[model samples]
Target: MTKEAGRGHALLVGAGILCSRLFGLVRQRVFSHYFGLSDAADIFSAALRVPNFLQNLFGEGVLSASFIPVYARLLAQHKQEEADRLAGAIAAALALIIAVIVALGVLATPYLLWAIAPGYTGEKRELTILIVRILFPGTGILVWSAWCLGILNSHHKFFLSYVAPVVWNLSMILTMLFFRHRDADRLIVYLAWGTVLGCLLQFLVQLGPVLKLVPGMRLKLDLHSLHVRQVGGSFLGVAIGRGVVQISAFIDQAIATLLGSGAIAGMTTASSINLLPVSLFGMAISASELPTLSRMAGDEWSADVATKLSARLNHGLERIAFFIVPSSMAFFALGNVVVAALYQSGAFTRKDSYYVWAILAGSGVGLLASTFGRLYASTYYAMRDTRTPLRFAIVRLVFTVALGLASALLLPRALDIPLQWGAVGLTASAGVAGWIEFHLLRRKLNKRIGATGVSVAMMVKLWSAAGLAVLVACMVEHYLPLYGPIVTAIFVLSTYGMVYFGVTYLMRIKVCVEVLGKMMRRIGIGG
Candidate 1:
């Protein structure tokens, strides 16, 4: 694998994620237009998540955190054969594991759907199970696509793996467009089959690039390889951590199921939007840093090694905060506009936009903490200590479930909070738990290597600029004449961004200053 230390790789990955996320937004828009936030959409949304439990527990999160580091280290040490062998063995194992999981999931779709959404009944419940069965094999195929992502990221081929999922998104969009009136039930079934085909295509697209990086890497049942065993050890720990996280998500869905019609679909739409910033900023930087950090992990511990790790950690956090802070602000202040611009068409209404925005606002609350938490978790993996993250993930899950139950389930009735507010409660509660997780990760990281991450002043400036942006956005929203949703969004967002950058410049935010200065110089402007 190749390791490059530069902002360019991170930018490339971020740009790819940006493109993929845009396509993902389109995918959701198509769904909203065709299915709206009805029980059919609810059925599909909740069912989609059930099979993803397999993907979450066994897919990218575990493989990237565990396998990539080790594989990248082997390549750095000029042990290409060992890296190839490890990749092959892990691939073989996942193939076997995913095949079994999919088969069982297909057979047990009813139980799975019930666990995911116990409130579903009659036709809704039956439809959810049927769609889940169609989606299971596809989910299994996509889990292996995470395998492709692991291989590509190890080799600094970040762009393709991140963007390739656009194919999957497009598949769904096309299905809906073609069969937009095929009765909601049959349309959802067609949609599920489209998803399966898309997953197959998404995985195949990456195989060529992966083979280019690791030649002759055919699958081998070589669990006996020492390197394979090492990856397996790391995989088990990371998988447990991912499983707990998935359980938290599952809990949210199960609770949403009880909340009433449209709750599951509403939250699902908002969550896809919420993930945009996390994937673009958080995943981009963390993925770019992994290959380099993996090599550092293989090095002998010393004062210099510790210094390098801390410096890398701090710099990565700086980049993460810059983009994510503004994203949180936009979601909090202009979520309805955002949702309306993207999704208010056909069956989706202005009311649906507000409902989705409410959840988006709540998600914004913990956006920074959750994103920063990803870097901290990656830091632990780089240090070869997956147990700490697993431990904290368990704590986070407990907090998430408790808070989720109190706010999302109980408070809505006891306190007379609206049903929409119940969805907000779910997202906001997760944000609170995210802060707890971030705090624990930071404390452990500080104990491991003195102090790490960005300075207090930098954080304050980020919050201040974002706060200022919100006020400006509010003023714009209040004063500006109404227009079409998309146009209104463009006008407000463009103004908010200009005002934000202008204020950040005045505040002398160092990351903004430096990145913009470099852009100016690159374009032949004054120094």
Candidate 2:
């Protein structure tokens, strides 16, 4: 793929995901206004993770990592009929699977919650069960929506696939806006129903484009289809790989649940903020690059293909780092400002804001590695090698779970940290594991592609640039003229970005220089 294609498509996907995540931020604000970090919020956070398994199991990540490369290659070879058949088969299989899983999940909600969050008791447990049942069918609909996403993305229709989440986010926002009452419990019920409705709407919205791509599509059970079986086989390994990550989250929720009220909500809110940049940079870049890489991998192995793949992979890695390094710095330095600006209104007090920021800062430690690791995993996907990523993911998961337990369950008592800060410990442990994961991913790829990633010199440069940005931003946040948390944060961050871009350019950071030149040419500014 041309650098232009990779960058442009990433921008398209990024723009869509950015809007969805922005709406998601607004949704969080709505939640904060109504719920804050109450037991109700904790219930929602923990219960949401349960239904999310349905989404993650049959959702975008697995399909993107396993199904897309094969499907995209078929399209590239002009195998429209075969590709459509595979799509239909997968859809049918997913529907069947989701039907069974959802039924069992709804019925076994209490048992599932007991296992995952054993500490939840009485009303909290009851409320969590209620929400999980309400969310089950909706989560099933989302699995289908993810199937639609796989098809749309393979066709190079990136925007609608990612943007569809807006419907889901807005559903909850509207519920919080219009349906709220003095009864927070009743409001939680309304929010749960809204989630179900949004999932259906999101799925329907993507139907038009998906149907256009596969005009002759129809549901069929074809276990005999080679690609069908390949996907099924790949799905197992990929699902296990993805599941371990989910289990890590589950472990965190379970452990956090033991920490009493608001811990789960605190972690949830912090993670949502952390995911903002990851979705924009990491997921957007990988999703855009997947189709191109799949096409390249479909070709016969050659030195030419190896050279091109290595270049594209390295470029993606650097671009992700260019954005996420500063993101980590910002989170670590000015997280309180960010938390207050977005969520410190209404029931969300300043203390609560600081709590969420602590978790965010801990999560920031893994921002670069986690984002970059997604790209490296995609490289394995392109090679149709799901097993390798799974192995590495297993290793990472072991470390994460080990460190997460120590921090969440042991370290707080031992070190005399607050129980709430245990959430921070859980996140920090995961971040440390994320670096190890990325290292293994890059190492394996480099063994084949040869020295194909960010250099240590550039790593230092990125860190230095990010560190300087954080220093300036922190100082301005403290001393610069501003209105309140929101205004102060905006001013500090905008100044930080301007200073960072100017300095990176002056320091001959090619990523910033190229991006700056693009913006300048686009708006008829400096040449």
Candidate 3:
């Protein structure tokens, strides 16, 4: 794809994701208003993790890595008949698997709480089990929705797949609003039922577009087909990689449970805020580039092919870093403002906002590395090298587990700090692990595809400008008598954004200049 085409597609993906994420934030804000850091909040958080495991395992990342490349390449070769068969086979097989998994998950909910939320007891544990069972079928439906995403993305239909989640978020939001007067335990059960309904709606919305794209689609098991086998092979590796990552997340939650009452809920809330940039920029660029990269793959690794791939990868890295740099800085310096703005009403207190801010700040440590690692992983997927990423992911998980234990369990007590601070340690340690994984992925890919990454000088410029923006925003917050979270965030964060764009424009960063110029022209201010 041309650079302009690639940027345009990435922007489309970003717009869709932004809409979904904004609604998701609204959902979380409503959730906080109802439950805050109470026991009910912790139960919901823990229960949701169980079903999310199913979705993450069989969902977007897994499908993108394993399904998209092979399927997209068939389309690039104009083999629509074969592509349809491949899609049909995978869809049939995925449905069968999801049905079995959901049934077993519901039956095993009591058992799962032992591993996932070992700290809970009596009523809390029983309620968690109930919620997990209620959510299992819904999460299975979401896994099916991911299959739709793979089909849509391979056909280069980006927006609807990403935006479909808005319905899912809206369902939960409205459920909470309708039952806002109810107690937490009963209201949460209603929310789970709402999630299930939303899951169906999310899939139905995508099914229409998918059917249009693949009119010849038919459902059948075709394990005998070579392309089907290829997808299966890649699927296993990606699944294992995704499983390792999930285990790491679960371990974090398990550790959080040991920390204290509010720890799990606090971490979950912080993670919601932390994931914004990752979903918006990291996932967007990678998702947009995957098909183009897959289509560009040559039969042989010739110099021309390597150079083309490296050029695309480097440009993607640059785009991610430009946005993520400022996001990381803002999280580190002004996270409390962000947390307050998004989720500090009703039961969520000023104290809870600060607690989440600490975790968000810790998350900023490896934001750039983690985002860059995602693009690098996508490049590997495009090259049909799924195992390399799986290996690196396992390594990252080990570091995460080891470092996480030390930082979260031991460090706080050693420092004579409150145990609640252990949650921040968990995020910071995970950030360190993310950097390690990123280094390995980049180093290995560079050897295979030649040198590819954002330039050091480019990073220096981004960081410098972002640092200045944060400094100015902080100074403004300090000097001005900001009254409320919404007003303060609007004024201060807007100032930070303006300063970052102004500095980058003055520095003649190509992307920044182009974006600013476009904005100016739209407003009738520039040539």
Predicted model with the maximum TM-score: 3
How many clashing pairs in candidate 1? 0
The digit string of per-residue lDDT tens for model 1 on 438-497 reads: 999999888777689789998889889888887888888888898889988898888888
Deviation in angstroms for 427 in model 1? 0.6
Poorly placed runs, candidate 3 (over 4 Å): 524-527
Candidate scoring better on lDDT of 2 and 3: 3
Question: For every candidate structure, what is the RMSD over all alpha carbons to the true structure, in angstroms?
Answer: 1.6, 1.2, 1.0
What ranges in model 1 sit over 4 Å off? 1-4, 521-527
**Per-residue lDDT of 127-219 in model 2, one digit per residue for the tens?**
889999999999999989989989998988899999999999999899888887648888888899998999999999999889989976789
Q: Residue 242 of candidate 2: its Cα lDDT? A: 92
* Candidate no. 2 TM-score: 0.98
Q: Write the per-residue lDDT of candidate 3 for residues 135-209, one digit (tens) a residue.
A: 999999998889999999888899999999999999999999999888889999999999999999999999988
Clash pairs (backbone) in predicted model 3: none
Structural similarity to truth (TM-score) of each candidate: 0.97, 0.98, 0.99
Cα error, residue 457 of model 2, in Å, equals 1.5
